[model samples]
Target: MRQSQNGGKRVLIVGGAGYLGSILSRKLLSNGFKVKVLDVLMYGREPIEEMLAHDAFELVEGDMRNISTLVKAIERVDQVVNLAAIVGDPACTLKPADTIETNFLANRALAEACKYNQINRFVYASTCSVYGMMEGDEKLTEESSLNPVSLYARSKVQAEEGILSLEDENFSPTILRMSTLYGYSPRMRFDLVVNTMTKNAVIDKKIFVHGGGKQWRPLLNVEDAAEAYMRVLQEPLKNVKGQTFNVGSEEQNYQILDIAKAVKESVPNAKLIVEGEEKDLRNYFVSFSKIEKTLEFKAVKQLKDSIFRIKKAIEDNRFSNINDPKYYNVEIG
Candidate 1:
């Protein structure tokens, strides 16, 4: 594996209309990469439509399941970032079959296409939810055993394994296990915990805490998550290729109550409500040491800053129709 000369490389970003994909596409374009975004655009392309005007940007409206579309999208691309997926636990639960097909099987198809086309780098967006539950004080690393709890996590694990298996002398596959992403996006989602809490606080002056809000988890700002990908794209291939790196910071780990406090700190008028006897079984704190040591990467955004941004966005009506089903992970239609 050889280091890629960052500038002038062509990148194909699958699911470019989605949250992380849209941000990553913009970051790559700003860094001078020729960008082609392949998305089904299920929600809309408004997030990236502006980039289409750029000479370096191209859009392919298609599905990953379609091999013909994947082939065409992969053409003349130096690297591929697979971000196309059903996304989130609720979303995957609502569309279990589609989740399996898109998150797992489609990835298999993408791997085959990349291998056949001899693509330079393949970066897969996986999640830390693969570490479902932790025993004692153990902090999970890339080497930690996976105990995936949801269909979404399971599918990501499958995709990660399959993509790595396809890696050889010609193909370099990098898996990024990202922490729970928050913060504003061009395609903003109120479905995420922080955003949802902040929205409820701003509109109704109350935020609900489910199951006493005790479970622990790591969080990362969307911009920081996108930055991790850029680092992989710019770094030496031998350092990142065929390796799985956890992308996040230990400083962001917090209990559910801690997040609620953070939201209240941003919105002092907000009240707290505890409801439901059911606890979300997924709980774990992850270590980001591997990526930090290897890539010299560290998350720059803090939780307070994310809280402030979401609060301001909500207060200023930046996210109008926050109740829209399209912005939520649950499929209303």
Candidate 2:
């Protein structure tokens, strides 16, 4: 592919300091893409601090709620990936207004700005939580009805609609309904299920299972999630435009207990403490056939590899304090 500007590919990732974005920016920059990250630095700059020295990487510290910020960020860019938002259910519940503005409103505005700027490829990071909890045993596809059980999922549902509403011949907006992300990222987070369990297995010697450990959750490694985005960025417009693909593998779906057990197996000595009550309502086995069939994209990273990455990061003392607020999305102001 020909580079967009300065003989290199120029792409803007709105939330490029988050868990997945941190890994993604590195991948793009390594491939000679002139990467620009626009974030409020809610987490901190350390996730991407190493990238600051790269000649092809640029950081625009700003919020996605600002229209002018997005307009300036996307100007003359080949692709725009929107990973910015109040990500996760608890985080959204804690800040409903902020979630609405960022997840739904600003997301819609960003898509419009991309279209207006004549940027054809727009990737909106959605979640499979949109299919909140299905009653059936069969796996849900992109065509399945979205039963968003939380404010986080609901906001993404609306954002998906609003962005797709702007889709036309000129603007190719692709929505990736991503599965639950786990594994190590430069912008590390212990809030995710696999990451948390693995960390606890190594450090605390016990992993807490909030639910009965039977709730189904589809898993996708952060690296694999990044790869899915990269594939969409490279695919032909007709193949991906105005389409929604579940970014995960059906084989990766595992019950909560299964995930915890995987951690126990890896750590060997950690015990799984299963609680009687299950609170978080999301449970669904996702079908990633659409993305695999269309773009030839399937999650390549193994589930165990993800667990090992988090475990190794912890053993290496990557985070000064695991309980630090910077590691969570909701803890920030």
Candidate 3:
């Protein structure tokens, strides 16, 4: 039987200092679980320093590549949310070897550690990018044949298969293939499409639409993405255990130009520029009904709202160091 919410159950967040991991750590703490953050602290702890004051929160500064560190982190934790990785296509492209070692091999090490430690509930944060270069408007589901175009997506697909294949009577690993996330974060990243356009509008007073902006992509606010992890933590084991759920909202799909226009509506003075002879290969609308039906989870933030938040952040000088390498992936660094 699955363990219920008790006072002593520990939750270990593998990359708790990164964008999504930072948010999930706080949410888990609020829900009465002891939170242990195991991250390299690549960007620093300013994002989650406040959480350290909580009696139930612990931080382990280490890399996921170190199997000894991973084994130590999982020691007594009831659940493990694996968010450690060299994220994004450009980042993976820059360091292909490191990406594979960290994203795939490290995850395999973590799964083995989890199995050895008897920590069953393993939640993997994957990407919708696994359904690379889709044709037409068909919404890609969990069963959809994966067609990964980028090295990063391929790494995630390999890791997902490796982790899920480890499922047994004792260990129940759950995979969440998250859509393109946008919105504010303590460790904010402006490289994402929505956030980048919003920042461009607020700072440069113009929005650039690449390749005429016709590429379709689904987006989810970062907060909603964090909430999906919480829902998985609370749901019945049978419903979520050993399952892969695509995290997103059906209504959130929009073309790149549409998102830019939404930003223009929010920032009226923002100009629109379309350029670039090259077109991006990734374009697809994802189906999120699987998670919605099983866990009753739905994204709460809209694209309009995300634009407003980002615009306001820029207006208030919250991101004065906009070009810092902290928010950029390996490629941009």
Candidate 4:
């Protein structure tokens, strides 16, 4: 039987030092789950540095692609949350080979390891980017056809297919197709849509709306994303196992121009600049009915809240230098 309470359970959060992982790790620890993070720490360890003091938290500094390292990380873990990936399109495009190796191949291997080790509850992080381009104001759902337009999205689709194929009575995996994430994190990233706009508005007093500013995106706060994961982890295995949830609220969806305008509203003096003509092909908004109906999960934070919160963080000089390459995934790649 699976552990009902978080107190004694062990969870291995692969890539636990990344933006979303950083928040999730802290939440799991506070709720009494022992978290063992296996990450290359390619960015740095500062995101999880404070976690080292907690006796329940453990960090295994290594690459997920390394089979030996993966095996070692899952030694006694009860559940696994796989979040390691070459996150953005630009980053994945810059390094296609690394992207496939890390995002798809390594993820399959980890799921296989978990399956064989009797870790039935595996939560995989997918993205709504799988719905590449939707026309006619249609809202894509979990059952919608995937039209991945980039290597990053394609890798996630393939990984989801491969991981779900491993599901059975003894090994059930849940896929959380997360929306574009924003807001502050210990390992801050300015490359995402909302964060980038907010950061540019705060620093340069300008917000750029590329691709004609009409592309639609479903935004989710980092804290809310972590809550979705925790909800799945806490729910009974029968409820979440072998399920794919689009993790975001319906009302949070907005177009590029609107997002830029919101950031401009927060910054007040920032100028909104429109550039190019529909360069980006990704423009699909998603439906969150499935997750809401099943897990009773609804994203609490709104885009305006995220914009103001991030703006305040920037105004307070929370980040030493937002221009640092570490803040942009593509730049790091």
- Counting clashing residue pairs in each candidate, in order, gives 0, 0, 0, 0
lDDT digits (tens) for residues 1-333 of candidate 2: 312333476889989998999999998887677899999998799999999999989899999787777777887688899999888988889899999999999998888888887899899999999999888899999999999999999999999999999988889999999889998888888878888788788998998898698889999999999988878887777888899999998899999999988898789988888887888788999898888888888788998877887788788988888888888776633
All candidates: TM-score: 0.96, 0.95, 0.96, 0.97
Instruction: Estimate candidate 3's RMSD in Å.
Output: 1.8
Model 3, residue 154: C-alpha shift (Å): 0.5
- Can you tell me which runs of candidate 1 are displaced by over 4 Å? 1-5
lDDT of each: 0.88, 0.88, 0.88, 0.91
Candidate 4, residues 1-333: lDDT per residue as tens digits?
234577668999998999999999999999889999999998899999999999999999999888899999999899999999999898899899999999999999999999999998999999999999896777898989999999999999999999999999989999999999998898899999999889889898989998798889998999999999999998888988889999998998889899898888889899889998888999898999999988878888888888898899888988887788778888732
Highest TM-score among the candidates is held by which one?
4
Worst 10 residues of 1 by lDDT: 324-333
Error of 2 at 158 (Å): 0.3
| lDDT (Cα, tens digit) per residue for candidate 3, span 1-333 | 223564666889999888888888888888788999999988889999999899999998998798778777887789899988888987888899999999999998898789877788889999999999987667898998898989999999999999988999889999999899899999898889899899889888999998878888889999999999988987777888889999999999888889999999999998999888547888888898988888889898988988898888888989768888887665353
For model 2, state the Cα shift of residue 205 in Å. Answer: 1.3
Candidate 1 lDDT (Cα, whole model)?
0.88
